[model samples]
Target: MIDSGSTATRRISRTSLVVALALCLALAGCGDSVAPPSLPIGSHRAATHVVAPGETIYHIATEYGVSVGRLMAANGISDPRDLRVGQVLTIPGGDRGASIGTASSGVRRYTGARSSRQFQWPVQNGVVSSGFGIRNGAMHDGVDIAAPAGTPVYAADSGVVIFSGTLHGYGNTVIIRHDDDYATVYGHNERNLVSEGTRVARGQEISEIGRSGRTTGANLHFEVRRDNVAENPLAYLPDPASSDRISFAAAGGS
Candidate 1:
C-alpha cells in the first residue's frame, strides 16, 4: 500500500542501517575481514573493551598495533595471564578501535616507572660451542651455547621484550631490550614464554633451548646488540662458576 517514492525511501533506510552496523563491527574488530588498524600517530580517543574468550595480551596488542607493555600499562594490568573472559581493558587507541581520530580526543595517559634490573646468563646450563665473530669464512653474529633440548633459557638482563617470534633461521626467537639500551637475542628456542613488550626481570625464564631454526642439535644461539650492532656476549656473561652446573649438564648433553 505504498507508492514507488515511499518504497524507495524505505529501501534507503535499510541500506543506511546496514552500513552503520558494518562500521560498528569494523571498529570493534569483529566479523570483518579487514586487518586491524594500527595505532595512529596523532591525537586519539580512548576506548574500553571486554576481554573475550581465548584472547591474549599479545593478540590484543598486535591487533591494535600498540606495544603490549603500553596496553598493559594503560589498564594497570599487572599480570597478563590473569585476564578474565569478561574483564574490561582500556584499549589505548582511538575510540571504537579506530587507529586514528580527530584532534578532539579523550584519552588518559598512563605514567609509570619501568623496572630497573641488570642482565644475567640466559641459559641455565650449557657449554660454549661457538663464539662471536667470523667463523667458517662467514660472520658469526652470536654465541651458541649447547644445552639440553628443553633447558629453560633465562633473560640475560631485565628489559622489555621487543620481539617474540620467528626470524628466518633464528627459529623461535625472543629479543629483550634492557634499560641500558642494550638488547639480547635468544634464538633456537623450543618455546617463548614472554610476549613482546612485556617487562621481564634479570634471570627470568624467557624461553627453552631448542633447535627450531637451522641448528644441528639442541642449543641456544645468544646475541647481544647495542644500537643494532652485534657484539660479544661473553664480555657480559658471568664467569664460569661451580654454581652454574654447566659442566654437569654439558657432560650429559654432550
Candidate 2:
C-alpha cells in the first residue's frame, strides 16, 4: 500500500507538470492573438481605406489621417460636404499625382518669361496709345497701335497663317502661328492680305490698319500668344519708339 501510494503521488506530480507546461504554451499563443495597434497613414502616403457607403468627408479625412481643409484645398473643392459619390479625391499628395496649385503657378511665371523673347512694330510709324493689362474689369491682352487707316501691317515673325477673316469684334483679323511655339494676331484690320495656311516671312505685308473691334479710332490691335494663350505683346516686343523703321517688311525677305 505504501509503494502504491508513492507511485500514485509520482503520477500526480508528473500530470501537474504537464498541465503547467500546456497552460504556459496557451498563454503565449493568446498574447500573440491580440492584434497590434494600427499605424497612422500620412497625407502623402497611399490611402488604405476606400470610401464606404454613407461615409462623410470628415470621416474619410480622419480615417486617412489628413485634415478636411487639406482635402478641399488640394482638390480645389469649394465645398467639403459636396463631394460626389464616385469622385476619387486625392489625399493631399496621395496617388503621387501632380499638385494643381504648384503646376499652374509655375506655368504662369514661365509664360511671363516667354513673353519677353521677341517683338514687332504693329504699324511702321504708329505710336502705342494703349498697352496690355486691364481696361475696366476686362483684362486687355494686347497692345493698341494708333496709326492712320490703311497703314501697312507686317507679319511679326515667320509663321503659317492660321486664321484670316473677319471676326465679330476684331473686324478683319489675321492670326499667324509661328515657329518656336509663338503666334501673333493682327486685329482691327481694314484688309487681310494673307489667307489661311499661307507661309509668311517675318515683316511680310499681312494686313492694313483699321478702326475695328469697337475701337475709338483707327489702330492696329496686335497680340502675341504662346501655346494659344494670349501673352502681353508689350512684354516681348521691342519698344516701338526706339526702332525708326516702319515695319519688319525686309526681315525675312530675300
Candidate 3:
C-alpha cells in the first residue's frame, strides 16, 4: 500500500507534466508548422513585376487592367516583342480606362478627326503594337509597327524626302512632304534607302525596319502630320479588315 501523501505528490507531478506538454503544443514547439493566412484579394498590388518566360506584354497588361501602350510607355518600351524573361516592368497606376481611351473589341478607337488624304501601308504583314494616343500622361505621336529586322518600309504616298538621317529619338528617319501640307515619317530603320530631296512614289521602299534609336526591338514608327501637327495614322491608312490593309494584330503582339 502506498502512503497517502506520496500518492498526492505523484498525482501533482503527473498533472504538471500534462500542463507542460499542452504548453509546448500551444507554442508550436513540437515542429508542427503553420501556414500564414492569405490576404484578401485586391488588398495589395505590387508596383513592379518580374517578367517570366513566355509572358507577353499583352498578357501582363490585361492582368493588371492597364493598356499595352501605357505599360510600354511607362517602361520606355517601344516594342512589345522586346520583352525578355527576368525583365522588370514598372506597373503604372490607374485602370485600363484611365490609361487608354474607349476601346472596342480590344482595339482602342481614335475619336479624333481622320485625315482627308489617303495613304498606303508602310509595312506589309506587320503588327501594330502601339497606336497614336496619350500614353503614360504623354502623347505618343505615332504608331509602332512590329516587324522582323530588315523588312522593307514603304512610302505612304508620293512625295519628296525632306529629312533623311538620324533625328533624336528617331533613328535613320525619313520624312516625306506630301501635297497640301501633309507629311509622313518613317523611323527606326536599319538604313535609309532614300536621300534627302529625293522624290519617291507611293509604295516605294524607303527604309528597312530596325531596332535603332530608343527601341528594344525591330519596328517602324510611322507618323502622319499636317501642318506639322500630329494625326492618327490609323485614320489615314486603309482599314485592317480590308484586302489592301496592312496585316496587323490589333490586340498588340508580334
Candidate 4:
C-alpha cells in the first residue's frame, strides 16, 4: 500500500499543475484579444511595408492601426485604388503624420513636377451630365460623363495602373499614375478590364460604364490630378464640340 502522507502530497501537486495550465491558457486568450499596437510618436523612425499579393491599402492601414486617409496622404495617394502589389509604402510615424481632408474640404497638397501630358476623352459618345466644382453645397471632385451602360472607358493617357478596386462613393475605380506628377481617375465602372500594375496606353479600354456608386444613372466619373490636386477635366480634355475622335490640337497637347 502507498504511504498515506505521500499520496496526499501527490494529489496536491496534480491539482496545482492543472491550475497552472488553466492560467496559462487564459493569458494566451487575452493576448489574442488585445488590439494591435499603434506606433508611438517618436518611438522610432517611420517603418516601411512591402505590399504583398492580395493586400489592399485598407488592410495595411488597419494592421498598422492608422487611418486610411493618413496613410494615403503620407504616400501622396489621392485615390484609394492606386495601391499596388509589391509597392513599398512609407508608414507615417512620430511627427511625420499627415493630415488629409475630405473631397469637400480639399486634400493635403503635393508639389510634383509640372506635367505637359495631354489627356484623351475616357468615354466615347458620352455627354457631360455634371461638371466639376461645388455642387449641392459640396465639392464635386470629378465630372460625370453620362453614357449608356456597358460603354467602354479608356485610359486618358499612358500610365501604370496604380489601383483598381471598389471604393466608397466612387464604386469600382481605376487610377493610373502617368509620367511626371499626373494621375487619372475613372470611376463608376460596371467592370474593370485591367488590374493594378498593368501599363495602359491612351485610349485603351480599361472599364465599362455603369451606374455604380452614388449615381443616378449610367456614367463614368472622371478626374485629372496634377501634383495630387484635382483640376477641371474640361480644361485638359479636347472640346467635345471640336471633334468626336481624338483631338491632336487640344490646348495642353504636346
Candidate 5:
C-alpha cells in the first residue's frame, strides 16, 4: 500500500509509449473540496449472471467486483474457454458490492484474476510533462500527460469502472479496476464520460483533458496501481509511436 511518507524524486523516461498516473487525493496530492455524487455500484448478491456475446471471465468478474477465480470456483468453471454466451454463473459474494474506489481503508480483497490484454495510449497526443516519483515534498505516484484541454482520454485496457466521481483536489476522476489487482486512475478530467460499474473496452474514451486540480496546466494525471502500491506506468505501456505517440523523453528527466 502507498504510505503517506512515500519518497519522491524527479525522473524522465523514454518516449513512444502509453502508460499513465493521477493527482487526486485518493492517489497523489490532496486539496480543495468537491462534493462528488454517490457511486451507483449497487449491491451485488450471490447472484447468477448470464454470459453475453463477446464477454469473458475477466470482464464479468470485474463487473461484479469479484475475481475470476472466485467466480470460477463458485460455479466450478474449469476452463475459461468453456464459458459461452447465454451460460449462467454464480457470483460469489452475497449482495454486497462496494464501489471499487481507491485501495484505501476498508478496501475489499479481490485476488485470482489477471488480464493478458495489452494497454494503449489513453490520449491521442500528449507530452510527458511529469514522471512518477518524489516531487516537491510528496510522492508523485503517477505521471502527467500534457495535452490540450478537451482532448479525449481512453481506457488503458478493458475493465470495470469502479469509481467515477470528483474527489478533493482531483476535480473529476475515473478509476477502473482491471484484472489481477491492476487499477488505473484518470484524474483532473475536464469531464467523465463513463459511470461507476460500467465496463469499458481498451482504448475506449473515458474522459477529457483538464487542469482541474493542483496542476501546472491542462494534463491528464494518470496512474497504474498494483494492489494499491504506486508503480511506474511507463514500465507497462507499449513503446511510443514515431511522431504523434506518447513519448517518455527519458528516464529520471521529466
Candidate 6:
C-alpha cells in the first residue's frame, strides 16, 4: 500500500510540472507573436533618409515643400545633382504637418504664414544711381535712387512703421518692420507721411524722395534687411532681364 501511494503522488507531481511548462511555453509564443502598435502617418522623427532609385534633390525638395538650398544647407551638401543611391541625407527644416513652425537652434523662425504681396516702386521710374557696399572707404548700407525731391515714395510691403525720424548717417529715415523678420528702410526722405507705430499697406504712400542726409543729389536710399542682417537685395528682387523691375534696393545706389 505504501509503494502505491508514493507512485500515485509522483505521477500527480509530474503531471502538474508538465502542465506548468506547457502554459509557460504558450505564453511565450503569444508574447513573441504580438504586434506592436503603429505610429500615426507622417509622424517622422528627424533623421537621415536613404535615397532610392530615380530620386533627385529637386524632386525631393518639391515633394517636401522645402527649398533646395535649405535642404543642401541642412545636409552639408555642395551639389544638388550629385546624389548617390543608398546615400544618407538629413532634411534641414520642415513644417512637420503641424501648424507651429519648427524651431532649430541657431535658426530663425517666422510664425506668420501670410503670402508675400507684390512690392511697389518706392520712386516711380527712378534709376538706381548708387549701389550698396563700400563707397570711398565707407560702408553704404542701402541703394540710392536719383528721383525728384517731391517724388512720392511708396511702401515696399504692408508693415508697421517702426521709425519715422532722423537716424545717424541715414537722415530722415522711415523704417517699416514687416512680417518674417523683414524690415524695409527709406532713408533721405524729404518728408515722412506716416508716423512711427502706424501700419502701412503695400504701394501706400509713406514718404517723399529727397536728399536729406548729407547727400549730393535728390534720391531715395532704400534697404531690405532680414533679421536685421543685410543681404544682397539684388538676389531677392525681381529679375531685371525679364522686365524693367527693381526688386529690392541695395545699400547704395545700383
On TM-score, the candidate that comes out on top is: 3
TM-score of every model versus the real structure: 0.51, 0.51, 0.56, 0.52, 0.54, 0.49
Model 6 C-alpha lDDT per residue in residues 91-132, reported as the tens digit of each score: 644442321111111111112232233345566666665543
By TM-score, how accurate is candidate 4?
0.52
Model 3 per-residue lDDT tens digits across residues 76-157: 8866678999999987652322233311223343443344567988987787766654333334456778888999999999
lDDT of each: 0.56, 0.53, 0.61, 0.57, 0.58, 0.52
Model 1: per-residue Cα lDDT over 1-254, one tens digit each: 11124646645533442332233223221110111123432224566778899998656654554434446657877566777899888876535443311112211121122122224677776776654432222234556778888899998877767678876566788887664446778888999999965888888889998888767688887766553444445545555676775531211110
RMSD of each: 22.2, 31.9, 28.7, 21.9, 18.6, 28.6
Q: After superposition, how far is residue 48 of candidate 1 from its true place, in Å?
A: 58
- lDDT string for model 5 (53-156, tens) is 99876556545644334456578775666789999888755233422222121111112122233467788788765654333323455667778899999999
TM-score of 2: 0.51
lDDT of 3 at 142: 64
Worst 10 residues of 6 by lDDT: 28-37
Report the number of the highest-lDDT candidate: 3
RMSD of 3: 28.7
Model 6 off-target regions past 4 Å? 1-119, 240-254
RMSD of 4: 21.9
Poorest stretch of ten by lDDT in candidate 3:
28-37
